[model samples]
Target: MRCEAAPSATSPPAEPAAVFTQFVVKLYSRCNFGCPDCYVYEHRDRGWAAQPLVMSPAVMRRLSGRIAEHLRSHRPERAQVILHGGEPLLAGPPVLERFARRLRADCQGLTTRVDLLVQTNASRLDRAFLETFRRYGITVGVSLDGTAESHDRRRPDRAGRGTHAEVARALTLLRAPRYRPLYGGLLCVVDLEADPVETYEALLAHEPPAVDLLLPHATWHFPPPRPPDGGEAPYGRWLAALFDRWFDAPRRETALRLFDSLLDLYLGGTSTSEMWGPYGSDVVVIQPSGLIEYNDVLKTVSAEAARSALHIGAHNFDRAAADPGFAAERAGLAGLCAQCRSCPVVDICGGGLRAHRHSPDNGFDNPSCYCADLSFLIGHVRERLTHGVSMLRARFVQGRWSA
Candidate 1:
């Protein structure tokens, strides 16, 4: 019933103090699969090549201390530590087990509860990995790009062959009754060429609990497949189509993070993700070398975009958070451009993701290259939500739920 009009232009929320709660730990910096569009290996930043192949025990100890230090200060009820990498499973289960164990031990007795999850390509997933993950109460999140055909197009092996078979095989295990609870979600990047409905249905086939439909990371320097200031807001049209399919489904097949976040915000509820709403940015990542830096995704923008002078061994995460570079991230609405701030949907779009606002001319102060698309998508959702609620109320005489 509480609906904020989706502004005609881009916008996000006002800046509240940023408290870091989510952390990513790169167990290994090397991967078995060769995804051509991979932000880490193929993006603007080539720093991954020089990074340690896997996190050493010494680095792990320091990372634990740094994360623990942050937890002691923020005292968030629960903290999420996602294990990632070129392909974290490349490091083997034993190494993962050791990393999880160390993190738990280091943060012991802290008010914050550390929950661990591993995000993987799922090409190398097997009983060995699942068993180890299970023992530590670690959850498993696989990156399967919808159907086999669609998935193969974006994610292939180094040898130029599709990895759909192996990924599909791994998903079976993760979807099994014994492991389904650990099935964090399916992650599908928006592919404009693919049929939106087909792509969504393919993901539904997995029976995942949730789905993360990410925009292919791009900046002004390098635009997405369908650029803005033109006739079609292709990405927006695609999502709007998918949103209708999801919103009208008689039964909820999966919880989509993007759509869910939008819906929650429309209903006067706070967001669970920085992807939307006016939520303060509070995510961080630790590379295998124990460097506490900004979100690793920023590497796609530039080499130095995500780097920081802060190292876990030398500084607590608090100091790292205070670093000028990282502070720019915590800027919230203030971080957005004048055009975005004046946009009607500012609260919903959040000036697009921070990374998407990049341009050499204006630095990180420009509207996202997806500005047209975000405007289209957010505006469409707001209209549908308002109309749907109005219709539902019209159908009910009392305008209230009754058993």
Candidate 2:
């Protein structure tokens, strides 16, 4: 199951290997529900419009073998493999079942702990599909942007119909005791208009294991909606309201990514330390064609830029990891922010998510689009910090410290 190509004799002695921690595999390049804000088609550099709808069997087989080999060699403590795509569910049950079966068999040696997850829209959930997911212990995170009005505004179908009803109904079914464990939680994009309190309550009713709020994909060119100059905070205000409500909650398990990041930063840790930071661990994305890319969101930055000449069948994980071009892309991220070099919190924030720094002129050599938002949130947290230790203790005890 393991293969380690000998390091070339001419090359200097190998440095310690960076452990491979997480990987995203694209099962298909097609989706059933075409959300307006989707990065794959709406904003991507590479076109998925003409690509194969599903991953070929050959690629899947090779992928399984390679991953198994990696597991055996690296003995990664916990390897997370997410089934991602334009719409991963587009590949029917039979296909996914075979893929998962092969993956299990391939990862034979080394007690390699694995975390399997699927991010889906929930519109395609069915008994058979549910069975496959449950069987593999796949944690399903459904994309539903809060209330119907809020969700329908941007997450509409190609025909412009609202998908909220289908998504809500699906959640209701998934939350039933028989399938509740499979209901991972809801993932919503921050829609400025929706009342954060209402959105929080509505999603909380389903009682998911967590909730994730994401800033809509945007850049200076196609900036996400913001309040006009001199107007009140747009995304900041909305998130602030949610933070208040969450802080006031009596009991909660619905984790919020933003709140968690802010909390970590406030507690003298890097925000997004678990996910987006530089020391935040490495993530590799595999497209259906077996092309390896970084921060899949970069797919939206340009069509041609997304096509890396890498394939799972032709390349081993070690070779791909040693790719000079790939290493350069990773290195280029740190230099993107002159501000980060001088900022004390760069280690924690990683200049915001890598994809967010992308721009036409400098590539991924810019700060986050949400820089202002982060500043606002950090200021709020710092103000609270300056108060007496007694006040901080009181707030924590009162549960009024949620991000």
Q: Highest lDDT among the candidates is held by which one? A: 1
Q: Tens digit of lDDT per residue, candidate 2, span 1-403?
A: 1235776879777665654557788898877776777878778564676667888888899888887787777887789778878778878888888888888777756588877788888788777888898888787889888888888886887788989888888888888787888877788888777888988887787778888888877775567777566254467667777887886578775788777777776676664333335453356778787777665666656676545677887887767666654554456335447876566656545566556667788776677787667656555655544664678788887886564
lDDT, candidates in the order shown: 0.84, 0.73
Clashing pairs in 2: 43-300, 44-300, 45-302, 45-303, 46-303, 270-348
| Per-residue lDDT of candidate 1, residues 101-162 (tens digit) | 88888888999888898999899999898888888888888888777787888898888789
Once model 2 is optimally superposed onto the true structure by TM-score, how far is the C-alpha of residue 155 displaced, in angstroms? 1.5
Collision pairs in model 1: 7-344, 7-345, 8-344, 11-346, 12-346
Q: Where does model 1 exceed 4 Å of error?
A: 1-18, 227-230, 398-403
TM-score of 2: 0.87
